[model samples]
Target: MSRRHVPAVLALVAGALVAVPAQAAHAATVQVPCSVPDLVKAINTANGTPRADTIRLARGCTYKLRAPDPVNPGNGLPVITSEITIDGRGATIERDGQGGEVPRFRIIYVDKTGVLKLIRTTIRGGYATDCPAFPDAVGASCGGGISNNGKMRITHSKFTGNTSASPVFAQGGGIDSPGSAKSTISDTEVSGNHVVYTGQEPESGAAGGGISNDGPLTITDSKLSGNTATVTPDTRSTAFGAGIISFFGTTIKNTVISGNRAFAEKGTARAAVSNGIPADSGRLTVIGGAVRDNVSDAPGGVAQGGGIANNALMTVKGVKISGNRAVAKDGIARGGGVRVGPSGTLDLKESRITGNTVEAPGGTAQGAGIDNPDGGVLRAERNEILRNTATAENGTAQGGGLYHAAGLPASGTSTLKRNTITDNRAADGGGIFRASGGLTLNGDVVRENRPNNCAPTGTVPGCTG
Candidate 1:
């Protein structure tokens, strides 16, 4: 789950599953008991089992997992090779690797593409020192969680209070999905998982506080709360997605992303601190959920969809984005809710985007809600865009509610239809700023969303405003 070879294995398995001709075989269920209260032995037995197998863990048992082998040569910890399914029966697999070595290991690692399923289990990624200098890297950071590289399906599972470092870094403190792994996580609760990237100079590397998805991934109908992705600037890296970081093509639907934070000041003196879905390539879609009460020094800067520096295409439908703040004392910033690059596109449909803010108290430029640079595009339909503010008075200019700078083409090309745009304030377009590029509107309620434009601050001809 930590390295990239697991995904390769999954690809091989999926290919084998699809290509290999086989007669219909009855499903084989293997019982791997942690009856001795030894979670590590149970895991080792399950992992050592052959492929096309199912491991059913006993119910009502409490497993104290042992420390992983310290001499794992490649990457962090050993890899789970078999195409196996591990099922926990109302059991708790806790990380019991007490204070010994500086490094630690993950709880469940699904390596191949075969179905790896879990039911009614609590996986606790115990606690460990996740500093950059630690021997183990992000994937193998201590804890009782799972690193999934293939098809990982979880139902009725709980993840609690997994800590990477004292402060937390970009470790998969709770659940880590590396790449090209398809996951179905239903009825799962992930809480209090912190990637404490506390090092002498924390800014050197970035960490995934709760969940880090680097490839094509999908998470549906889950709860992620109270997770922290904190990094020290001295480490010279980015700390983001205190709750979740989705790179590559990722889709999260019918889930809640709340109370997560990326605190960069505690570690070192890094320039930017990011949280919640740091920028990367691919398609990210968030539908039917809320992204609220999450914070970062620069939360989702220069990107769209959700949170920091995203370069992928972000599409949000039937979602609520409220009380999310993007803060940076530096002079330059954009897209408080989303800082989209010049080429990225942000499309929101039937979504309520309210109470989000972009503030640059120290430097100059900033945009409150959506900052579409010269080539960027922001399209909203059948939604309420309200009460968002951008507060940069001294030479801080552009669309306060939404800035369509000369860099990002005209809003004339962007579509704002059947939307209630009101009560938003800023230096430029207080309600919405169509600075240079024009925005198009159709059947939109241009209520009180006001901007400080030069001409009539009313609806401009091009912005259907």
Candidate 2:
């Protein structure tokens, strides 16, 4: 009787072992349902898994994150802490409230140990304000939609209607990366995002209306448009990079930056895309892109760099800079298309700089096309500069096409080679203006500018008025 019982129990145990091994040998793809609770559970499981996981969201479904996570108060979803890839499959994940709005939390947050890959999703209406746990700005909040302190990869996605809502300091309305983050974005759309400050606090401003990265970032074949960085009230700070801003090691290739704005109600406004502010040592390289229809307006303060502004090293090649404007009502407006700071070096080649304007009806405006304000080194080669305008009502407008100001201690240098500067209009120096700097021209065509070509009749050598 005992021998028979032993054999029966052993047979049952052997069956259980074989069944467990069969199931563990082949894992199925984890797919989350359209329900919010299911999605939350799926992400929680993925974060706890040791191996990298890919979770496919319900097709074309909208996952509404109605409330912040209980563990992390500022995040709408679970904090990603492992290698996870969320394949949206045309679905959308948004922070849901009153139109996904008003003091909202972020959609996704990646911790330092996490790696996130987002594909084919749309992240909408995420707002980050007073987020102390964020890696950058500490208490000031950063990254309305997605924030990464680890690594992130985004492809074929969209980030829209997000805001980083601190007036004191903030960064990245659409996406943000702190100093420890590394990201690669490809074929994405980041639009209609904002970083706005309306308080009258002195030096209250923010950076990067669409996306901001303080670490290594590479963006390719993407579109960044309709983003804004606006600072209202009587503040004296500066709002920088309405489209995108990076501190260091950023490269943008084959992207489009258009219809972005930097508006300062009382402070200074920078351009659509900023490599780095003057205080940083960031470097940017832009290739085969278009920067167009951007604006920098500061009626009560200065406006600099309507399109692309650089205070660090920048290399731009095969790009188009067009239809950008810099406006200052009672102050100075400089650089309608591009502005290079004194510590900056710009190497622009084979680009088209056209139809840019510096409009200061009640102030002074300078450099309709490109302005390198005397401490920067600029080299323009084989480019077309055409039909730009520099106009000022209170002061004389100068440099319709390109402006090189007086040299500083660093002594800025300008070299124009095989460039065609034509059809530009200004009060003085319609073609190219060299107030004082090292100017070397070789095979450049400076002609047909309105008012005159080269102000003071002899400022630019090898050019006749």
Q: Please, what is the TM-score per model?
A: 0.76, 0.91
Task: Report the C-alpha lDDT of model 1 over 89-108, residue by residue, as the tens digit.
Answer: 78887756467643455555
Task: Tell me, by lDDT, which candidate is best.
Answer: 2
- Give per-residue CA lDDT, model 2, range 16-89, as digits (tens): 00000111333335989898899889889977766677889999999988888889878888988877889999
- Model 2 is weakest, by summed lDDT over 10 consecutive residues, at 11-20
Cα lDDT listed for each candidate? 0.57, 0.81
Error of 2 at 288 (Å): 0.6
Name the lDDT of candidate 1: 0.57
